[model samples]
Target: MKEERLFSLRNPWFVVSAGGTALIAILSILVGFVWLPSVHSDFTANGLWGAICSAAGAPSSWYKGGDNVADAPPSNVVVLPPLGIARVNAVSSGRGATLATQRCSMCHGVQSPAGVTAPFLAGQYADVIYKELRDFQSGARQNAIMQPIIASLSDQDMHDVAEYYSSQSRVVQATAADGHDDSVARVLSMQGAPIRNIAPCAACHGVLDRKGAAPWLGGQSAPYLATQLRSFAAGNRHNDIDEQMRNVARQLRPEEIDSLAKYYAAQP
Candidate 1:
């Protein structure tokens, strides 16, 4: 009998094991590098090498000349960390209150009566209010009603008004009568759908972690909130810095939007 080497190709078991391992490696590479990245809308594959490079966290392949370039910044406002931290002074708050009563009361005031869909301004972050006013003034946010009103507001006036709103208490309103449908909204708010790249609503909306300039959603009207979500999803509202809201909104289902809106509206 001839002595046989354990690692030799002549060994049937060795041959089978090696072939199986090779097949698995090939399948993994195909799935991880090609199939996974191809599913995202933004993926730009230059070729096999490009796909591999992107999947491996490497720079674009040398063959990629101008195929997959990033778009320009989407927002005009540059939100700084220190923004919205200013305490409300009596003088500024008083001026802001006067402006709110005279100019903003028609839509935003509590006494506007029922069936109104406009967002309540009370308890909103000052930075959020100021940035939105600036966007309205700059034509970055389009609204026939708001544009003309904001156009005449000076920078100081915007600041005063924002501070005033921030100082006011959140509107005291009735919570949603139905708690059965709210569980979906609560789940979305607390635990986001990671597969869809949607972060938890609480991350930016002040439940878990608050991003700068992100507004407080508690006590807002359900109709107003739902309308805004629809606008964001439809690309009608794109003023959110870095396309953050737009991206999240686009991934949300219509039912999810309704649920989220109702959930926030019910909060105190």
Candidate 2:
């Protein structure tokens, strides 16, 4: 009996198999670690090691809080403490009412009439309004109209304005007369597409569980809702924490987005 060296390159089968495996590994490393991360602006500055780590799905902000970048300019608003529950007193509400009447009423009030797509501020959650205002002021969320309007408002003024609008009555439209079938939208809202990593809309937007700063979508304008969904899908609006709404919007089809908007608009 003769003993043979299994790893010997002289063996044609062994050489072919080993060479193929090495080639595959080299290609995989180049594509995954080099090519993929180079396209992303955030990871490009970090160089080769950053690309390798990102490809492995490591969290990118782990080292970002260091003292080196501390003096660097802030990329986004710091949303903490201010987003907490705001107290609505008579004085605050009065001041808020004055501000809203002077600054916000032209678009959001009853005098503006129907067919207007700017979001109805009446009966909105104070926290939701405040967060959005803060985002607009800090440039985390951009709007030509909102940014300038929110620019002059101080922190207390925003809080007051949010409180005032929240105290007003929500306008409830005749959803039954609208004659739009929304069974699919109802399903999407109540029980999200778990397979696609989408959470139920009600989990955050009020019903099952209300996460912090999540707004109630019921009674919102259909056009506004649809536009916002499209914006999120296109990555134009991304103030949502951890890209939650962005992920869901990206998964929805065009028809589904329209249906969901109509469904929520019809809610009492």
Candidate 3:
């Protein structure tokens, strides 16, 4: 009986037939709108093929703890507590910055005093950069394009890069939109709506002692921020843990996203 069961389960023909039948039954249970159940995420979630299959509406792929394949979420985004602005006076001159240029620029690449698609990493936060790298490495930031590049990095490498970028001085540059004074402009200026309750762009992003997963906003291209915030709000960027960023973006009045993007872009 066990051998017979194994034969049925292992047979490709039987498996495909059964899967199709089960899928039809599922549609019927949903009252026949050509419905398919959403893919159930699990600990064993693997590569593109597995994700594809599951998204095709496979059944019974879950384990008891949901998606805790190897570990749980961290209480903090970094290995060490962030050194606030006061501690900036204490670190060795240019040491962390040098390490970042060596290690991180391997993937991120250095600026040419020109321009490129890869992000310029100078002046970013240690914690925010660290979290992104960790998420990429741990499958939390799943992407067919990025997963492999980040998968091999050691934990220490991530920390070193974070510290390096955070220590650099921000450069100044302004965009054409910087000249505009529309409703979007008023919001970024912190003169409107929830901006009153939410705090200034400088408070979390433009300041020296900002905590949490916020990255630097200075000199970030307005076009990029505008697209990214919209992506998060619309669920196009769903790979983030807890979707904290998506939640943040969703709170924006449509104009607020536009305003914040223009605001950050105009920063030098």
Candidate 4:
């Protein structure tokens, strides 16, 4: 009778103990699988915590533009030449042309050979040209071909080359029809895909307003532009100031990329 009394399911102490164990099991399942994981997932998706963690882990000299602040050497500051193409002078152009023939014409040419795929430098903004050269020389940008070539150049040489290229007239190329909606590219260039957090290409690339060091994309080659966009999306091109290109490229679809490239290449 004593044993029966102690072990009975009807006893208040036995019932209380069983209830406590069940409660613990339920809480454990909720906390371990559901609550904790949900919290972590939310934190990751929001990126606030992740950014903080990344900042904490990064070196003190790391700049938001991916440059090492302490290691960066002084570069010649580029000032924009006056609005018209008339600012290109005979002496400067001659010097630049001579340098181009000696070094740059093999790859980037005023008139490239058939099937040559390098970006045409003609009519590009001088500031943009200078910045790219600087980035390449500093190792802030990596290009197997460009790095070696730029490494041999002095700051004055870069400026001279940039002057030559920016002085030449741009040739508008024929863009292949990819059968995608042209409006999509147009909208992205002018208005941007706000839903995807993309800024208008014109905001930087100088159709609407020129931003600092933004290149003129008006007559850029379609294939070259497309390749660059894809590279940025893939994280292969990391030299853009503030990860701007990376962020925009990552949000683009394949069709959008093709369309935008075509649109810009067709522009005069």
- Best candidate, lDDT-wise? 1
List model 1 lDDT by residue over 1-268, tens digit each: 9988889899998999999999999999777767876785334324556655656778554555868765434568865544444545889889999999888888887332233487788877888888889888887778999998877888889888888887787765665522435776897898876645688999998879899778888778788889999988888887888899888898788888988987887777
Better of 2 and 4 by TM-score: 2
Off by over 4 Å in 3: 1-118, 178-183, 188-192, 195-203, 207-209, 238-243, 253-255
Q: What is the TM-score of each candidate against the true structure?
A: 0.73, 0.68, 0.54, 0.65
Model 3 residue 52 lDDT score? 45
Q: Show where candidate 2 strays beyond 4 Å.
A: 1-87, 110-115, 174-179
**Number of clashes in model 1?**
0
Model 1 TM-score, 2 decimals: 0.73
Q: Mind giving the per-residue lDDT tens digits that candidate 3 earns over 98-165?
A: 55555556645433112222355666666777777777777655457567655666666566566666
Q: Provide the clash count, candidate 3.
A: 0
lDDT scores in order: 0.77, 0.77, 0.57, 0.72
Q: Please list all clashing residue pairs in model 2, or write none if there are none.
A: none
Tell me the tens digit of each residue's lDDT in model 4 across 1-268.
4454755687889889988999999997677556755755422332544434543565324346865434223234334644233344667678778888887888787543222266778878877887888888987767888888768887777777788888887765554533334887999899986635689999988768887777887666678889999988987777777678888998788988988988887777
Q: Which one wins by lDDT: 1 or 2?
A: 1
Task: Give, for candidate 3, the lowest lDDT window spanning 10 residues.
Answer: 36-45
**lDDT by residue for model 2 over 1-268, one digit each (tens)?**
9766788988888999999999999999787667755664334445666555656667545774546532222224433433445565899999998999888888888322244478887888878888889888888777899888878998899999988888878886664325566877888899986634567899988889887777888887888899999988988887887777888898787988999999888776
